[model samples]
Target: MLHDIGGQAPNPRQTKIAVVGGGSTYTPELIDGFARLRDTLPIGELVLVDPAAERLELVGGLARRIFAKQGHPATVTTTSDLDAGVAGADAVLLQLRVGGQAARQQDETWPLECGCIGQETTGAGGLAKALRTVPVVLDIAERVRRASPDAWIIDFTNPVGIVTRALLQAGHRAIGLCNVAIGFQRKFAALLGVAPGDVHLDHVGLNHLTWERGVRLGGPEGENVLPKLLAEHGDTIAGDLHLPRPLLDRLGTVPSYYLRYFYAHDAVVEEMWTKPSRAAEVAAMEKQLLEMYGDPALDEKPALLAKRGGAFYSEAAVDLAAALLGSGGSPYQVVNTYNNGTLPFLADDAVIEVQAAIGARGATPLPVPQLDPLCAGLVANVTAYEQLALEAALHGGRDRVFKALLAHPLIGQYAYAESLTDQLIAHNQEHLAWA
Candidate 1:
């Protein structure tokens, strides 16, 4: 059993929260998350921040409706001012992605020309995004430090593991959250025709780049069913899904992310084309959804979530947050927290995801005893490059940035490392403002 730090649920009371980037499509889910916990974590006030007034109002309005409908008396405020949003809050959530989806697509695609996978969440794409995001995220961290000195930051940004590592190294209290692993686990269980709870998993490593070491179904009684289920039921579930699972099934190990690169290894370009075509597929799916229906924007309105009246926050997002706040109950989650040697397979200082127990003391990442060699090597390599990039971001220099780019396994030891480095830098030079 996992430990629960929150001794008991706090009584209903006002709690101030600052949600940065309120205009994001994710705001409604966040607001709903708070509503579900209102009985224990009463909302005193909510501060919403965004640049566009109209977008801010839309999300802010939705937040209000959720709160009112839940019978919570929390006051909601919208602002374009950054400092005002950070002031007097118990917690702050950072959810901004600098260049949006189009920019991300470019970041991933350009790296494909070189025969490497171009995903902004990991590898060289992760480094490039870190260069662009560290400054912005840190700026928000600074505001939280000054305005709400004791507040804990919940980061929902991409490259979450790397970003969370940077913040903690800089002496800020923060936790980065992602649900990719959980999403995949559920998909796998459904493929095997088992209840999600009936499936047990061992997950480790960074966001968008972890591996499931073991899987068991049916608990002690169901232990005998796993092999047969793997042999027969696997096809049904694998066939229904349109993701990396099929590859994972063939390898006899769950595929967390490496599968994307497996199928499109030769399409990698330079830095600008780093995102894999798999992302393009997801975009294409979204576009097809829009076209299939009469609407052009499928996600413009609310989405049909997994649970009803569960929370506004994404199911994965809420699971992490509520676990930290002591209101959630999930078997396990691999979240980004300060690496205090949780994953022995990697460096102690390398931030990673292992099992975690969230309660009164906040998220407590558990230790991982062992890991698959492939996953360990990949995470270590990525973390090495990522740490160098963080250093470059902190102390602006071409040398540090180049060193980081060259250190990457995909880009390292290649004759074109210098030229590729130069071209990549030139393409994403806007990121140089920070480095």
Candidate 2:
């Protein structure tokens, strides 16, 4: 990848931002961020777009209350009309779920029946989500493009790499955002007795398939702290990764939690069969969260949002939006952008999540140190599979789905691929128009 080093001052101006999936239980978390970071982002208007009227009412009301409670000046609005919602927006955030938790339940369950990881952003299940989500998201992106040509799309949707790639492929001004990298930076910063701002990670690889090969303190070259973190907090770290400390010590790099679906695939699959799917758990949490949101007195985000996952999501989203919209902050942040020869192995067109300096022109991948063979091998394999998965998601067929499953590292067996293809299609028939 090519690297350009520089800094630019942010032009202070009021912004009108739209949250495409505003009814999501996660919206409050984002609203809370906006309220706290108001001095930085300075929102003029905030719109929540969703087809669910009741959810929009509950979420929009609570969002307004949160801003009011924080004494924020932004006005919050709710709407089902995409064109109206995105009209004149400076930036649009996408976080939609195609079939809700019921569909997610199917994605998480059927994959385990074929002995594959059931997570929503990594393997077969993630592919199912991509297939159902891509078309809807593209349509939304098109509306944003039409309504406001200069609008920047910040995607927080699942299967982020695929969705971001689809948006970019359609010539939309977009960038992908994920919490995994920031979550690690915050954790490492806490352990090192420093502010999260002091830590910068060599977070590399495709979405959900990345690793922190190096952790630099103060600046990109300040000091390497990955060894120190692994040495002192190895057990706690290992528990979070669900991998052995010895493996981390051996590799001398910390992998993202999603890597567990790869390093310990069979174990995860076996263990998953014994528990309720994450979708079921999140669905129940949303039920309680919506109830809490309906309370007029509850102005702050519920504590239960932490259990809803996406920790530090609002901060990352705000940071990215500010940088993308020219409220310049840090010089670098982990983002999903075009590879542009960053890996030297993957196609330039392949979207890889890496550190990049954000500007109004969008992200340019930072120069990366040579990757170890082990990491490169897994990244290359998964990137190829992601290519096929995106193709299948865009143009569906039983054979294409089978092809995607067969290419997955966690489901390489022909028998497993065939069975998963049949079961996945059957389970997702409602969402899969092609099926």
Candidate 3:
């Protein structure tokens, strides 16, 4: 790793940003994104917090190099101590997990064997992960209050909505981050062969669990783009591409995985054991890409001012950051924010993802017009699950956990729900000792 001592003096009023999981494979891109903002904004210091010393050092070294190369050297510190890392920070970014990816794969596949949707994003997988995470996340939040009392938490963890809601319920300043909130519409625009700028969409519900109620072209035919997209690219968009395509096509519109559970229905799988073939195909493609690229960590270290390829580095994420920073004074698109009774279908205090006007203060959730029956039911189930999980966390009662599992759509029967709940709790013996 290299370091560059920049030629510029530090701005006294700059904000300090702390990325909690700096060792994560995804941090390079995010760090690169923040580095590019140096020219337009005054960021005083950058902190990378991770428990692994080697990984922590690598990221800190990268940040120093990036800053020096840009001729704007900001103080860079790496630490295993989260308290020291978050001290004086303006934002705490989280992307940690109790169980790694392999464990997550087990969480998904095992539930699949039980005839349930196997995804960390929603359903049983989400509920299980949420149960394990609530305590840890709350601990982190309490520290944030003590260290940086006014700091905002930018959560990038799985069970995004659930975890975000838990922190908010505890009265912390936090907002969950989900690419699905905006990535789905971008996918829709690509299928229609139009610039994403030319697409207009309305989305609502929870993270990885939402429905796109409207779609339109910004051009002459501003009518709903759903019927056309469904008629033209329906099969290829939903079928050939593995993702929300099938779910969206079934609803005759797009399904935002922002709240995926809402879109789970009888047609999502064949007899509930198999997902559409597109998911399999996409998985294969992703596997091939990983095999070709291997772990990004193995390559020669990224340059101090290096830029990664693809839209993630170049377009979408950059656009979102710029919009939030008020770069062009362009209106920020709506996104998931705390509902202040704006959405009638969900509880007033529920942290729901909706279209919002973003600014320096961050996202402001907008009111949704209405929710279809399926979407409404999904919001209800997931919201109820979160509430029950909170109750379980507060009281340390496994009964609350059992009730959450019982309320799941696929396991709503009293006997089946209780049996599955007992089995899961039994299996998670080590983690559930407190409850």
C-alpha lDDT of all candidate models, in order: 0.64, 0.88, 0.63
Identify the superior model by lDDT, candidate 2 or candidate 3. Answer: 2
Residue-level lDDT tens digits of model 2 in 1-435: 111111112233589898999999999999999999976677888889888878888998888888878888766778888899898899999999998998888888877766678777777888889998998999899989999999999999989999999999999999999999999999999988999999999999989889998899998888998888999999988988889989999989899888888788778888899988899999999999999999999989999999999899999989988888877556688999999999999998899999998888999988999898999999989888888998998899999999998998888899999988888788788888888
Which runs in model 2 stand beyond 4 Å of their true positions?
A: 1-13
* lDDT, residue 332, candidate 1: 59
Best candidate, lDDT? 2
Candidate 1 TM-score over all chains jointly: 0.78
Q: TM-score each candidate.
A: 0.78, 0.96, 0.78
Error of 3 at 410 (Å): 2.6
In candidate 3, position 190 carries an lDDT of: 83
Each prediction's RMSD to truth: 7.1, 5.8, 5.5
Residue 55 Cα positional deviation in candidate 2, in Å, after optimal superposition:
0.9
- What lDDT is reached at residue 51 by model 2? 89
